[model samples]
Target: MIDLNQSDKRQLLFDAARELFLEQGFKKTNVAAITERANVAVGTFYKYFASKEQIFYEVYQAENEKAKRKIVARIDADQSPKEVVKQFLQEIIRTSEQNAILAEWYRNTEASQVLMNYNQECDVQKNSFVYRFLLDNIERWRSSGQFRRDIDANTILALFNVLVLLDNHKEEIGHEHFPQVLELLAEMIIDGLTASS
Candidate 1:
């Protein structure tokens, strides 16, 4: 029942939305602008996405996939578990800042919370890049004795989740002190997760 031409039109809209979001951000972008840029009829966008938010969510996912590939490729197998954990935390901040859509979510706490709540409701954490990355590497680290044998990947995930929570509250925690706090916590998490030499 799907028209072959439908995909091309949808992709055009998707690409145009991404370009516009990156250039002017979510608040400034309009659905009309997206359709204009995509060279599609204004009504055609409604056939693909319910709203600007829906299209932005699609763009966000695509951008995250790109980031995950880069992050996975950059991680060295030779690094110890501690360094890997630190790098993982650092990459969270780096990738978010690098992507405009991702940064917008952080800047708007209510929107960020809504997105996080939706993820929780859908139980998508298992399919997330960070979860899968930690799960895969945790297994390898445990086998190679780089990580504590008794500790499960979930513990590490919880720690990382806490770090994310702290980062979200950085404004209340004092922007000037957040870096020091994050550094201390990362060190503690690394020390906790690593096996003794």
Candidate 2:
């Protein structure tokens, strides 16, 4: 018998499901496969998740939190607004590329639909840390005379969100040239946001 606590079992299931989803996608990954990968009996999966979709949703949320924590950890108050925006973009792109599950999730329409439904039910978009962080940073830059006062903070934050969305297509955008594209985009945003003398 595989002896494990509730948290351990849940974590094991999540890890196994995430790998399967990344490798085979949400539609192709099944509960039995997840349990097999987790080294748990098929019935044991029910104790942790209601369905494969539920496990995939949890995995997506966990990965999103991990990426957010990484970006938050790198934030520095001493950095200039331009530097901060550039760094944030760089971190988002790096995190998306490094996390195979996240990259795969973005690539799959089925996964995205499930995530969208989950987000709607949870009101996650409004309460997201990334959304709040961008809003707060935009407000701070404007108040500090670093960014243009004419533009709304939400609008600036929306642009940032757009850049993050673009990261999903970085591979098709030419991995060799994606970094340059991001840099150029960052420069344009910084220039547009900068306060006039």
Candidate 3:
């Protein structure tokens, strides 16, 4: 099912590009550097990607896939929906911190434009996976009168957007306050979706 040669070459480019991007940055790193680092001919690089932007796009895609995998693994452990949600936020924050290139990319580059375009072209499911996962798992709570029946599953997706904003403001809140901040936001969301006791 997998094209070994194509996959290996693509990964070679991605790994090399990611290293260079991390070291010198996107604007500073040229295709020649990437090709040399990848031990591939310049033509070989072009065979897999149209431009440096395209290569970075693949790199970011792989990063997102890794993030999703981490999220899935962190959530799969036995935990309450609320606990899982907390860990999910923690995982994202941890991942972003671990991937300094991602933070730097978000801060210095209008890289979101390329990322958005890539998502539009490839991710038909978009943000639905996260939203649906939360909604399905939380439904039992709703049935047990622990959550509000009126809250839409999409509301959880919207909450994810807020979490992103909060995570991005790590300095303002500081890492020491992350758990409280996340819990507060989660509580606010839960309150909005649950009947008042």
Candidate 4:
């Protein structure tokens, strides 16, 4: 049921929107700017996207999807859960920094909220790349008696979810050394999780 021509137009709009978002950023970019950049009628944008926020979310998602795959591919099959989680935390920061729109998701903005909502949805389903990647790793470790059997997977999942919550509170937590803080926090959590081993 896919219309090739319409799909092409939609992609044009999306490509244009992503460029504008990366260049001017979310606050400065508008629908008309996107449509003009895409070389399409303003009305055409409506047919493809509900609003600028929707397109921004899609743009951000594209970046995140790439990051997710990259993170998974970077995983070492022989690594322990602690190392896996540690490397994942580091790689996620690196990838986020590499993508301007993805980095924007860490900021306090409407777009960030949308991105968080996307994460929350994926969390509930337990199907997101990172969630599934970590979940499977945790379960494997738990079964191998490497991770603490006393601690359920959901509790550990909640523990990792703290990272996202902390990102939202960097200003309150002091942004001066937030990266160090995150590194320290990850070490503490990973050590605690692997204390049994």
Best by lDDT: 4
Instruction: Report the Cα lDDT for candidate 2.
Output: 0.79
Best by TM-score: 4
TM-score of each: 0.82, 0.72, 0.69, 0.86
* Candidate numbers sorted by lDDT from highest down: 4, 2, 1, 3
**How many clashes show up in model 3?**
0
lDDT (Cα, tens digit) per residue for candidate 2, span 21-124: 77877788999999999999888899888888788888988888878877978888568988877787777767877776676554666776677667668967
Candidates in order have lDDT scores of 0.77, 0.79, 0.70, 0.80
Error of 1 at 153 (Å): 2.8
Candidate 3 structure, TM-score to reference: 0.69
Candidate 1 lDDT (Cα, 0 to 1): 0.77
Runs in model 4 lying further than 4 Å from the true structure:
1-4, 107-110, 117-125
Residue range 27-50, candidate 3, lDDT tens digits: 788899998998888998888889
Predicted candidate 1 versus true structure: per-residue lDDT over 1-197, tens digit per residue: 44449889999999999999899988789999999999878999999998887787778777877887788778875788777766766776678878887777667665465456555556666667767877788788878887777777678677767876785677688766776688689788778777474
The TM-score of candidate 4 is 0.86
Clashes of 2: 0
Better of 3 and 4 by TM-score: 4
Could you tell me how far off, in angstroms, the CA of residue 123 lies in candidate 1 after the best superposition? Answer: 2.9
User: Which pairs of residues collide in model 3?
Assistant: none
